[model samples]
Target: MSLKILDQLSQDFTQLLENSYDYNVVIEVGKQPNIKLYKAHSAILYQRSLYFRQKLTNATKKNNVIEFKIPNLSVQTFDIIIRYIYSGIVSLENFEAATIFDLLIDLNEFQFIELVERIQAYLLIIMLLGFHPSMIFNSDDFKTLQENAFIALLKQDDLQMEESEIWDKVILWGKARTPDLPSNLEVWTDENFKSLKATLQHCLPHIRYFQIPSEDVLKKIKPYHNILEKNIWDDILAKYLAPNVPIASLILPPRKKATVQLPSRKASIITPSSSIITLEHIAELSSWIDRRSKIYNTTEIPYEFKLLLRGSRDGFTVLKIDSTNEILGGYNLLIWKVPNGKYSERATTADSFIFSLKNRNQSILSRVKDESTAIVYGKISQGPIFGNGLGMGRRSKSISKEWYSSETVYEKPIRNIDAWFFIDEYEVFQICKI
Candidate 1:
């Protein structure tokens, strides 16, 4: 019977490369004291990598050794390349975007066709969410970018950089890529401008100059005016001055999607700087419940609102002002978890509030005053107000503090009600210290 050798062969091969056992060739990679020595088989190198084959062929005139002094390649990135060569796997976890991009460059240089495709795809995913231009534009890595890769990046609508920042980076990269100009702009001649323009020729069309703000344009772009065509610059300024007048320029829309997500803040009454928002930025909404749809007419508030509660662990409870202009929810503040799970009654001994949000910017906050009072945690209950109401500012001792119960609706109030106090369509918000 033949031996059943699963991934043992792969493991053995990986070990062989790692230990440098019986290797016929040595690759002296990188530069100076930071250099790395990788021992590999010439036969395996030729079979597995077209890049290695060509490189080794050129170096192997008479000696068994082949040395590559790549000053740009880091020892860590080279180790990853060597590991991939032996194991046929690229481990990207725990690595940063700049590292992936550097390895991607090596993969391209060696014509690692399949690996190139795989790494490029991975790089695009990082570009969408992880890659930050600031990490690379100042480095030599930006200068060595392949033309297609550079162009593709310029065309990206979701690059996660402000248009002004992108413009600054493009100028930097262009200057680095172009051949010698005077170090100082004052010493530069017409020839220098022409050379820089030629270098950025393909990239210029994609810059989306119209999207840059006027202040940034005046400050950042004016210095580079010599490199741009007169007509192009004129049109960009015109668009900013008179936006109503449309021009036949290649004006692109700003990237609105995939914005940076702010970190979660706890529901509290103070700001991150510990400033009291209620006393400064916002005021408590009046308890007067006068606003409503006309009789026989049901008008919705036309907004979505949620309550943020600090005592309930920054609980997010959503409510809707219905077409009948009724506040349908004051769902007790609770953290989101699996439904129908057993929960306890949360009692807050301190001040708390709920916010109704029209847009994320505009909010109306409703405050709660405790008279030795407690808001009971319902079995997924909204609020007692939406359940029936705090009947027209009517005070009753015998009502469920929070939950909706079929057994006990509130007893007859002193009056029917002009409207429900807690159930009135009022914008609500809770100050969060997040």
Candidate 2:
């Protein structure tokens, strides 16, 4: 028999990740205040993942160091994945089920196909042992699960549920996650259906449409036909009318029956880290930043908001929630000038904007039109002033309609009618490329 030394090899490789002295890549992970910087070598990263290889190929280096920022990923998850990249050893027993599921999705994004498959297999084994899909999908926390994690669950072949019932759960979950959808489907607009489709783009493909009963398809799936691709929906109908004829759509195989009965356990929910806004808001703001007509999905945001200041922590306010629950704020792309013996100074930038996040689905964005006086930096005591559109008085922190108007220096007013309001709390974030 041949001698086995894989254990020692794995241990040595793990040591390299922990104690390497000459690492060149500095990866910044997590949001501010709880962030971590991981020192990694480019060689190991480039060799391990095609995703990292492409990133490294395009990345510019300063001081012989290449930098990467991953703001959306949790520090704990990144730590586990990065170690596995070097050592090829991952122990999943210590992680929560939700965390492991999220790790699988993150691995898929990193182009770690082999690792993803392994993780998915492990999930299947654990799920078969006791944790049933009924427990997971029915739990209160189901809606809070990551999109990728939910999609991964749908890809399983041994799930113990009727195909029609699975379709209902998918629709329910999509409705819960998608914002601003009307409760009554009859009143839904074309845009509303399109939004839900985008939210469930990856998810819809995994449904076993061929296995669903025809009566259920007529009653349940027909109403949401707008969300399905034209060919997929057409093929679904064609299959029933003309069974002998071949259809264009790929019909997924029916799910296999589980041999053992599964016990139930509550699913874990990963709460968002931000206090001010949700992920949907972040996705919308990121689209505005890039000047895109189509908003980015929550899963696809490319920038990270690093906490620069918080009224609760830093003792200052740049954003204020009024008594009427309106969120008002301004963003400046230029630096604040340190007034040189002057009461105030003006700076110019076309990227500056003032905003009103009216609600979850509605927002107002006003970009700088007159760059000559885009922003004004007053004395250190006074807060930010956005070219007469939005302003606050010194020391007292009082807001007045006289100082706020949208007639000049901006595209349009964030607020329709200016009125005095009190500042409850505010926060400032530095947007960094991810």
Candidate 3:
């Protein structure tokens, strides 16, 4: 068909809808003077909107003009739906995120299944490609999504936003339900806490409270302490005071490193798919452990490890098993090989810390806790290096293979690794606020 013929058909059909010559139903949408009265054809309305079909099918009014009282729907969105019904076009221009969101919900209510799917795909593509998250996730103007929907989005491993920013948005969403919330929560009475808590009950459980730093917790969570349960606060303190927590207390999975734009963290065997603990972590730890060593500064990776790196040879190894939800990686921080009582090129550093974590009851796999009282700490000069605990209380044979591998041997000082592996699955992490 030519463009002119299609245009003429669209115009004729549109005029037929607009003229309302055979109109039998009056959709009395909205209320008061601002209310809209769309004079629509009963046959065409039934053909387009399933909702109209169903309602008109059950109509019992004696008068020729039947009225539908839909007070919840905005007249603007309704008008767009009407336009689509007549012209098969859903013009999305001049509409804010909030409006589009509202339209999505309204379409579902009207049983516009095809349009609903289209809108969902558009929003998903926009979010996945890293377009606008504010329109959908914002708290102030974000009124369209249901509680379950918002919670599901927050739980996304690759949600593209700063963890801190997510926290702020969540708070904004909670405050919406509790209008009386005060800016200064310090003065919030008991009633205020209750209101906020009720609003955020589902949201609180999903927050990765442990990932937030202790200082940030005090700054952000402190004011809302009234909303948190007492046991949560106690656990937060324990993690910070003693980082090498034997069992994981953090309930939520650590926010997966999302975008490369966010800040970096220490290299562990496991990290968000988008990230790996590059040499920067090792260099930082090295600088902290021994100020005498020159910081490693080169894009050239002198060493790379996939499965295992011999700890005695400055071997850097990282392995994360998704099947087991296990993550463990170690740096042979101060590897000094003395074959003939002569040290080879050593990867010496001031810091040596090994960390691990799992999806469930967090088990820590690290060195002994009190180095002074420990055997290796007293015998070795570079002692008290790795993480805490009385030698991660328990371990696994597979995960602890790095600690004491004789495949390559180092000097006597490097022989301080004591507690090795035990079971197939072990866990450990600094149960700290940060």
Candidate 4:
């Protein structure tokens, strides 16, 4: 029989963290007017984090104390991390979800694997609890997100924000990425517009351009029309003038709005066979298929989904896992046929498309730009292929074993980053009218 005294041990460590005079590490965090200096024992930090251990190993020591600066980190965020390093405890109940998410990303950077997992689980719970706020995109740190992450965020269809506000944020983010531009748009030259357009090349296609109101378009977007493709800008102008006239530019469906729904007294159950998707995803796919301007509710979906193939049950699979939660797939309007004694074959169709269903709420759709190569057929060993947008062949293998680049055969990239991902399980469903 064994007895554990973790509570007392934890308390002792907490007390030591609060009042230890023998501390030999000084960390300067944040910048000028908002800066702070934190004192801690190097032993605790060194043992708690691999990142700290590496830093301390290379850190110069003077007067028996190791000192370093983390100018980018906020004092409040570091405070929480430092305390957890000693006491192995953190209370997030008092903090907003955005604050907690920021902490989670910082913790991951410090290689605090266990704590990062815990924080991720907590954040997932919060999402399930339906506690979402637009504060993250509007935060001061919005410009600090990586291009890929920012693109993924923008692809979210259910963001609780106005299209105009999103356009403003996009412009802000684009300006941040392209430096040395004047604050005033009137002073901007053609070079300034070109630079910003290049920076936001992948981002521009995701915005629901047609969804923005005419007033907001004129007020918020008109000043930056030069940054957009000429055809897209022309289409925008044409749309407002003649709402019924069709244009060449793709008009993405309007984003979904969040609403509180009261559950019925009687229970209803509907389940789809696929493990990777849900009924709501089915509704989304149906809307895309029919070219609807708005998403349909699950109960309103008109297609009866029939399971055709299962990856796990069958032999269909991909290679290693990607760290991100991006799901890549394609829909081919034409039927797949094996090449007759040839190494490969190509099928053509304008309707075929590739997509990245990123992180559940976000999606990026890339339609076939070159109809001549909409689908590529290869041997069973090579795997199923969908043009250069999503394929397995020399091009896929030539890139780094861990990544794949878009060949631009599609109108845009499905996944923003040139990366390869694993498929734990995949299923094909045949959609039939009810």
- Where in model 1 is the C-alpha error above 4 Å? 1-131, 138-140, 265-434
Ranking by lDDT: 2, 4, 1, 3
Go through the candidates in order and give the clash count of each.
Answer: 8, 0, 16, 0
State the local distance difference test value for candidate 2. Answer: 0.73
Against the true structure, whose TM-score is highest? 4
**lDDT for 63 (candidate 1):** 64
TM-scores, one per candidate: 0.36, 0.37, 0.34, 0.38
Error of 1 at 354 (Å): 37
Off by over 4 Å in 3: 1-132, 135-140, 143-145, 259-434
For candidate 4, the lDDT comes to 0.70
Error of 4 at 240 (Å): 56
**By TM-score, is 2 or 3 better?**
2
* Residue pairs in candidate 1 whose N, alpha carbon or C atoms collide under 3 angstroms: 268-431, 330-382, 331-382, 354-429, 355-428, 355-429, 356-428, 365-429
Off by over 4 Å in 4: 130-365, 368-409, 413-434
Off by over 4 Å in 2: 1-80, 83-131, 260-434
What tens digits encode model 4's per-residue C-alpha lDDT throughout 303-377? 666554454443231222345545566777777655654368888888887776643357666778899988888
* lDDT by residue (tens digit), candidate 1, 92-135: 64465546655665665666767867665555544533245556
Candidate number that wins on TM-score, 3 or 4: 4
